[model samples]
Target: MKNLKKKLGLALAVTLSTVTFATAYSTTAEPTTAATSENVNENTIRNDEPTSDRINQFKDIAMYYYWHGGDIQQAEKDIFKGITLKGKYDVVENAFKEATLLDPYDLDLKLSLASTQIIQKKTPEALQTYKQILNLDPNHFNANLLYGVYSKVNGDNSSYKSSISNLKQIDAKKTNEYLQKLETTETILDENLNTSAPADLPQKDHAIVILGYALAEDGSMREPLIERLKAGLAIAKQYPNSKIIVTGGVPKQGITEADAMSNWLISQGIEKDRIILENKSTDTVENGLFSTAILDKEGIKDVTLVTSASHMRRALTVFKEASDFYNKMNGNNIDRNFTNVVYLDYPSLEEAHKVSKDEILVIYRDLIRTSGIWQYPGLQR
Candidate 1:
């Protein structure tokens, strides 16, 4: 009876072992469908952030080119497509917002967004953005300029007055120094022009023509045309083997002052090859920047700036600063000097009085420039 019981228990154990082995094999088996893995990858591409990230990189490149005059509308469209294509405006808004978070010190991004806000007429949002900018860089020139515009547009007289006052206080020393040098050069130039035998004027290696406040109606350098042309031409003549750049855009109703100046110079025996006309600039800053491009293109090394005695000071500062930025970026150096070509044509006592009055006005206008007129035009106080 004991042997019979032992046989029965062994058979039961074998049956239980077979059942357990079958269950274990089922649990260890993997799903065999390739479609599941592909679905996972597709979900990752749609839900993952790589697409948005690529869009941002492309947007930055677009903005860089846009700032250099390479098509801003296209850049804006590209950025719009990048953010909206993913059905994630939040992602883009967050990306720009977080750039500020990662580096709260990034004033450029802050100001850019703030400017957009102002453009959209979102006054409150723009105010907040300006506040953020001020927190980062209180002395940010363009920020203050826009803030003034903001206040002015919103009827915040107190804020506008304060901003204008602040602009006037920033830095008048550089302007004053340039004005002084211009005065000296003009005095010397005038004495030489009037003298029976021209005084031995200082020589330079190149000439810089500054287009100031656009051309006047008569194809002259605004109200004080002769002085600017005189100073610039004097420098070109002083500099042997050097040329004069007469810069201005097409005049409002007629030919440009550049063309008029060219005609006048040729009549005075100055050869056409010695005169270079930069007739595309509509503003003072462009006068320097585009002229620099021409100089670089021509492989001309030395530079001398010629403008109105009143206008020369500011021109010098802008010209020098821009030239430095350009050279640093291009990784090259050109021999350059921004000597004032003083137009000594203050012929009449009455004319001198008029110039003095104009000088006072010029000083005030120049003081307003620290606020960045180009960026915030409405704030040009």
Candidate 2:
């Protein structure tokens, strides 16, 4: 739990840095209008001023906890008294429920609420929410896509079949080609299930890429990152000829994740030339987008990815798609083989088993973003 808190807190801090919403809203400021995905001229806001402010406040708080990864200690801090991490989904649900009551036509808010419902594994509630969104606009991209994915995952074929057209309408970014190659959680888990590294991988023309996690405010390596570095060190020792690439761009105080990772690797006796710093990416998706181009330049053929098991599926998919994206632009099929060295972020094997499927399903949201649709459908990448 000590390690978990450090990891989650750093993530929250980074997310907080990017927050654009008003943390405090005027209690007397009335809800003059509500905007949907299209932001048409419809103005359906009917709530009192106080209620409008309350739901926005609740939405902000829910976002905080969502980024907090449900860490109990952080949830208790600030003015968030009486709210433990366990109540995170409840808070999220309440926020959406109130906001929807204020303006039933706000498709964006409804989508966010449906997303939270999915995270909480409230299938009935989530389906209802998605249905509500679809009822409002049958062509809504996110709602149709999510509803399709969730239905297929739960073995409901009819809804999934009907939603493909709407899902395919929004953003493909020419990435529709790689959709066939995307590995589901069911396909890859059995082979990469171990948290330990394999020793027999080839060294030449291969690279060991370490993904970065958020760092402490003072630029110190948190326990989880050090653990990943230690694992990278072991891989470096085992495959002495393999190049090491550390990718992260988010800085704290002054040091970037790549700088910190490279320094740590060199301190552990790894050669300086063997370690490459990719300090331009801000997130896992960007890590894929930026690092693959560098790999192509260095003539690296096969790549092994080192990330927490919690992040492995999404990271793999993103990097694979990144490689595909670059190849599509250059018209050269660069060989990008991704092998995984999974770090067990769960407290126990039992818990990992229990949550793995849900983790797999939840990654579709990020997958959609990777395919060029931003969180809100109106914003395209």
RMSD of each: 22.9, 9.2
* lDDT over C-alpha atoms for residue 173 of model 1: 59
TM agreement with the true structure for every prediction: 0.43, 0.67
Q: Compose the digit string of candidate 1's lDDT tens values, residues 193-256.
A: 2211133433444455545445564555554666565555554555546677877765755787
Cα error, candidate 2, residue 298 (Å):
3.5
Give candidate 2 regions above 4 Å deviation: 1-103, 165-186, 194-202, 216-219, 250-254, 280-283, 344-355, 376-381
Model 1: lDDT to the true structure: 0.49
Per-residue alpha-carbon lDDT of candidate 2 for residues 1-381, written as tens digits (9 for 90 to 100): 222212222233333444432332112223323322343321222223245554554454455554433434543453244555456666556546666776788887787777777767876788888899899898776677778777866668788777765556665632243245434433544444446667667769989999999999799988878878877788888899999999999888789999999999988899999999999987877888889879989988788888887777777777776777788788987767778886778887555545454666656655656656454333212
**Consecutive 10-residue window with the lowest summed lDDT within model 2:** 1-10
In candidate 2, list every pair of residues with a backbone clash. Answer: none
By summed lDDT, which 10 consecutive residues of candidate 1 come out lowest?
Answer: 4-13
Q: How far out, in Å, is residue 245 in model 2? A: 1.9
Residue 18: error of model 2 in Å?
A: 17
